[model samples]
Target chain A: MLERGEVANSWRHERWDSFRLLTPNWQSRLPGHRYEGPDPDGYMTMAEVTAFIEGFAARSGAPVRTGADVTSVRRAGDGYQVTTGGGEFRCRSVVIASGACNVPVVPPFAGAVPGSVEQLTPFDYRGPAQLPDGGVLVVGASATGVQLAAELRRSGRPVTLSVGEHVRLPRTYRGRDVLWWMDASGVWDQRFDEIDDLTRARRLPSPQLIGTDERTTLDLNALTSMGVEPVGRLAAVRDGRALFSGGLRNVFSLADLKMERLLDTFDAWAREHGRDGEVGPPERFAPTRAPERARLQLDLRGGEIRTIVWATGFRPDYGWLDVPVVDEKGRLRHEGGVVDSPGLYALGLPVLRRRRSTFIHGIESDAREVIDHLATVTLAQRPGA
Target chain B: MTTVANGVNVQALLDAREALKGAPEAAQFVWRASSKWQDGVHSTTRVKEFFGLGQEQEHKSEAVFDADHPEVFAAQDNGITPIEYLLIGLASCLTAGVASVAQNRGIQLRSVEAALEGKHDIRGILGVDSDVRNGFNDIKVTFTIDADASRQDIEALVAQSQKRSAVFDALTNPTDVTVEVA
Candidate 1:
């Protein structure tokens, strides 16, 4: 991110603050802290998360089982029995956490490109170091876009990220994590069942702040600083080059100017909203934009980029297990926290109680509700005593 | 055949796929088979290419065997057989999902198994079919999630597996198959 000009002003300051955090871990009477993302908010670190999970498991007495291959599960009269290589273990409920990617979305044109044209799915992505260095294009533009573009740029790879519409947020605001508001405000709290799936999936306006009360950024300046040109959406991938849409009519330099103008427009809007009593100013603000259906086509196409990172986001896969809990389009069917199947349940799913159901922070709250329900349902299933 | 749904002339995709031609070009992946699972099952078999970037090629091969015929057998690559590899991947993926979710959820699973059955209407594969169902109709995966998890739990597991398995993604989310004669 620092390489890509994505750091903006916030990153510049964090670079120094990072050393301060390292001091704590130095055993200076206090614990040494790794200021994980230059974000000053001190959101729960990986260590904290691990500790929490360990505590929860110890409290619940659920023995941690790893790499145990379970063959099947059948009903044992009132309860259930599970068969695994680790031997049979009984459980009242289950939370299937098989991450989505059930199927590789093998694009049709993948083979159309020359054999030399390397292809990889986000599913296969490990890191920027692994990519065959050439001007690279990343296709999707959801959370994956901003992060991948920043990482690759730092690695000194001229990278282009092709993003569709997406929701953007900053790392912090008013000394608090942007996630704080994203969760508290209804912006990320709306339930998926409350709206149509289309509305649920697309991006929307948000109060999520960016880096500590410092400065914020959009992708425009970031890609340019790393010499990672921004090309339009990929139309087709040929042998040596990929065909693209938008801004091809003019010189590539003109494209960069367009990004600047868009950022300027975004800042101006934020200022206006701040004054208008609409969206208030955060202790800090991140450069961001909500996909405007109107200005979208009208907005001048920005500079040409080499690759498109499909950070466009993820989709759920349900092809092997046969259950009717899924609806017409193949997503699980559930009302709020209740699932379609009896003695079966799901939680921490995207858009469950609200749009935030899928967010990292929201998962904690969702898990609480789910575990509670599981306890209740398990007791209910006990032979109508 | 075309049908109307939601007032749109929806080409029956399943039928169109049935009508769709398989690989217009004849290409194959032939490996030397060492031992036979089936006696008459040709020690050497062929994989017909249905679509996407490959030369118009025919595959043929001989069989290689270990010292003990009854002991073990392996096929040496004539070349990369993408389809065969994909089929194996699909089967493996479905089975893995079944097992993983079962364990994570605390479901006592005795045995989880899946069988892959591919359906490629001859017309679709040969490009002779006026009706399209170019790809396999259904890759049936019968998940024998042991007998432990209730029929309900097992069924849900199966559904979750099917819903979450990536192999199924490769199958259902058919990538655009663009072909050009270079």
Candidate 2:
């Protein structure tokens, strides 16, 4: 396998302390793969996660050429020609597991936020001390945004959370972790075909959750109540000032409504299986609503809000791939890991096969499917009498 | 009858502002609402002839309320209930305050939308919990407004409106109520 980054799992090279694997320790690996390292029960840090990936590659004895930085891959004869910064290689099949979060997407107004205010994406964010003296304006209230806002707040920096449309889910609901319910209720087993609106589902934000020692729920309401100034979606930045919309309440309502619907689904499932009694003790976490102001403009030079962290989202970069497997918009077109071009396969995409396809647990299953397809294609193209 | 904007007389508002600037007691106003029970958990409120519009002309609005439950020791589904009216009152009061403050600030507002949500424990209203008060545990008001003003200016206007709103004052403060059999 060819790798682009210096390390195999370069995505884990962040300064975040508590990076919880979405799936628990036991389920966070390939099917036949096992972690013989330390802390098999809890989460792993960045170093630990990197070491784990490196250990996996070593155990499998897979010929991984790291630091190659593949520039382009094109179909050559019956195989493919992969060109990287270092050298070139010919391969029959390729699995694109580079990950979904390759490029950080900042808003267009980021340029107008002024050069005086330090800006950083979660990709390069090391810690709070690295930021300037003044507080921060953390845009996008996704998991990363909330986590950073909370962590920064804990470090004595005032945080203004600009929340938008987000999925609000309790980290632990009904005496069990939410992931457990997702696993037990067969949520991860759902295929792409089962999804009614793939566009909306693909764009849905990761649930508002924080992975701590003991799971804690983090939503806009919770953040606001915890001294975090909640604002609307960022509208624009100009003249050393930032503007925000009055859509905060609407976003909060939508998140609450979605949470209610999700809880209702869980409730129905529990009742159907006669496990309602066990999970019947419902916990109310309704956030207090406040009057939404129309707009907010902050003076960037006013010794307050010295930094801006754009946790908006990410887009995959397929600029290097020279195959016809990608669409006009650069998104890979694949059906259950197999690309339309036959030999090219995609893995670790958000909801590629099942709901957890991009998750650690789901990677193993997706890898198996790709391997099966690769095996079939290789057999068909073998030497004949 | 002279034409008015958003049921507000700007000249009268200016007059009141000026009058209050010189003598604050000159701006004293009183509002009254008379509601009568019609049937099970249903009532009608007649609001008219409020003081301090710079004139004593009669303007009336009749609002009805009906509990959304079966007619027993229970609520009956009819119309907007009292608590819902409370939310409406608070929202409308704050919204009007926002408009007034914006106008006073000379802000050209494009659009203004307000939403209100309140949470109440049914046990309090049902008298099941003697310790619980029969009122909303909390109320949240959200306003989405578009105006050609800076964020600080808009926030200042909202704060000024909240400070000057009569309904806000009444809700936040304790008042004596006299119920007499006449």
Candidate 3:
């Protein structure tokens, strides 16, 4: 979630409805140089996404059960039986769409928060339905950090944003949306077996910092324009103030390291492929990488910082999921979403391809890969199939 | 990252610079890549710095083979590289030595394979501090040899390999890696 949060429309001019574009029109002109799908089928509004499954039931006049939790899953000979809070459903094979950001993660920070301040994650944030009228200190600098910085500032919140390893996405390349190169490169192209390990590690693209206005640095400018103070990494919070690593009066660390690693991996990848055929690309030739030259420092010792809004990043919690698909690092072990364990599939996780696993626009290819790999087998085949 | 208000000390700098002009030349040596001799022996000697990569991102590397010409194994993980292969050769040489000694004594062999990897921190190699470099680091190897030979007989083979492996000799007593720069 923080992965998308940091770069999701980081540009300034991009309103919430910018990606809602379904057709190729002039309105997308300001949306940077490229789009995964310039001619989208339709823009599914937030309401549409929420009501999609419910609306299907409503249209069919079927009685539906919402908020039902799964209890356990077991292999029943050919097909597996899935037990839930409501009832059990049996299927030949099950598709697990539990996204990486599905869980509301709370980092076990060292200190306690003050009662007077407000601290909420992007997960709990439901469209500013109930926001306090106090000053705001937005922790984390990725997509959510920047977005919340913009959102609160626009809504008259005295927001202070702490900048961490802020991801950089080019606004345009010869006047095209950044998404164009992604599509053209093997970033979304499929050649699973042929990809080398180093290339896979270094060439995978990361979603760059997208300003709301498509012009580069628009997101950073937007928050600063709206008076959102960009601070440093968060150290701790006590009373109603904060502290910063830069020896500021009080502040916090903006992002979590895991989130930064995901972004940095992309930086390494863009450099590896020497994006656009530059000799000694960033990944190959260390000097080409922007991060290599960046003298970034995070001093996380703030004397006065209040609430720590952890938009750090999202982690997929597969606790209740009693599956043997994950490796020691709590990540799925597979090739293009094909698990070593039978009758299981994962979707929307990071690093699933040459660079395909990082974006919503690119996730569909993985979905197709999973569906294709599973099509040939059935319940009558493997023991757990 | 804190810069001093005043600039650097010029007298201290000039003295340091002048002292370096009279320094002796950097060491040099011949790097030979030799195949195993008739007795099945090959040796290697590397400086501690190059013995193992430190936790330096600057030294990041991955092995790549052309897709059209596939090899036995290709990866970028902690797998052994060409130099590491010397260790493998040493182990294999030991195995061969043991087999030859035992084969003359009528012990048969079925199969033999050895996979090994070594780990060491760079700070130790550079000799930043005596306490820091620490000790032997670690070496892990899984040698699988199948034959009609019993465990007692294999013990003799192990001893022979340890005694005759020339690569192991260099490891026990490593010659320094010569260094020079223009």
Highest-lDDT candidate: 2
Candidate 1 chain B lowest-lDDT run of ten: B1-10
TM-score of chain B of each: 0.49, 0.77, 0.46
TM-scores of the candidates are 0.46, 0.65, 0.47
Each prediction's total of clashing residue pairs, residues at least 3 apart in sequence or on different chains, is 85, 6, 45
Candidate 3 per-residue C-alpha lDDT over B1-182 given as tens digits, one digit per residue, 9 for 90 to 100: 12221232434545654664454232222223322222112222232222211221221443232111113333323333344555666676766665665554455566667777766565664578675544344444456777666764565455445545565545433334666663
Ranked candidates (lDDT, high to low): 2, 3, 1
Give candidate 1 regions above 4 Å deviation.
A1-40, A43-61, A69-93, A97-106, A122-124, A172-176, A196-199, A202-218, A235-312, A317-322, A327-330, A371-378, B1-182
- Candidate 3: what is its chain A TM-score? 0.62
Give the runs in model 3 whose Cα sits over 4 Å from its true position: A1-44, A48-68, A76-79, A190-217, A237-307, A327-329, A358-360, A377-385, B1-182
Query: Model 1, residue A250: what's the lDDT?
Result: 20
lDDT string, candidate 3, A262-360, tens digits: 334545555667663542223211111111111112222342333346667666666756667765646666666666667776666665643556454
| Candidate 2: residue pairs that collide | A290-B141, A291-B141, A291-B142, A292-B142, A292-B143, B69-B75
Q: lDDT of each model, Cα atoms only?
A: 0.46, 0.72, 0.48
Model 2 alpha-carbon drift over 4 Å, by segment: A6-8, A14-18, A34-41, A276-280, A291-295, A377-385, B1-182
Q: Tell me the tens digit of each residue's lDDT in model 1 across A90-204.
A: 6555554433323434445445554444556555555776776655666544444554666677777766655433444434333333444344344565656567543335333
Better of 2 and 3 by TM-score: 2
Estimate the Cα RMSD of every predicted model relative to the unseen true structure. Answer: 21.5, 19.3, 22.5
Error at B24, model 1, angstroms: 28
